[model samples]
Target: MWVNCRRYAVQAHNIGCYKTQQRPWVRQLEATYDVIVKECGLFVDQKRPFLGATPDGLVGDDTLVEMKCPYAARDLTPLEGVRKKKKIL
Candidate 1:
């Protein structure tokens, strides 16, 4: 399983490291949409403290964004497989 794979762990960590490096470019792209993005922290549900989400960026009051900075073409392969599987089912 990916959760138990060392490569998965390293890739997950790399995404965090690269996210910071890619922020400037991401912000520039977002500006084209006229959306002012802001940093967000972990949001814990009041009734369910154990359930939380830390979105990449918040756009205005109603939108939450998640960003991905894939390092290689194969970085997106897993998602492609999921999409294909969903279509088959």
Candidate 2:
């Protein structure tokens, strides 16, 4: 796989956007659902030390929140975006 500056820049921008939008979105979810979203750090598997996953939020004891803030579908609701662009993000 080839790494390009444009790709890196795009990824960085997307990450920045997501970070900027994340808190407000999480707050809305908490207010709407009355559930606390616990922030998480990188979680490593004990048995497989090399493998890990960092979830966006942890809801309750068992549910993990994985957020997708797609740059291409920023102006559309999730359902509409998914319907219109099935492969975006």
Q: Each prediction's Cα lDDT score?
A: 0.58, 0.68
- lDDT (Cα, tens digit) per residue for candidate 2, span 1-89: 12332344344325667768778877877886799999976677899976766677899999887676666776776468669964322
lDDT of 1 by residue, 18-81 (tens): 5464576457647767887787766877998666666767888999876555444333444573
Candidate 1 local distance difference test against the native: 0.58
Stretches off by above 4 angstroms in model 1 are 1-20, 71-89
Question: What lDDT is reached at residue 39 by model 2?
Answer: 90
Task: Give the C-alpha miss distance for residue 22 in model 2, angstroms.
Answer: 0.5
TM-scores of the candidates are: 0.55, 0.65
Residue 56's lDDT in candidate 1: 68
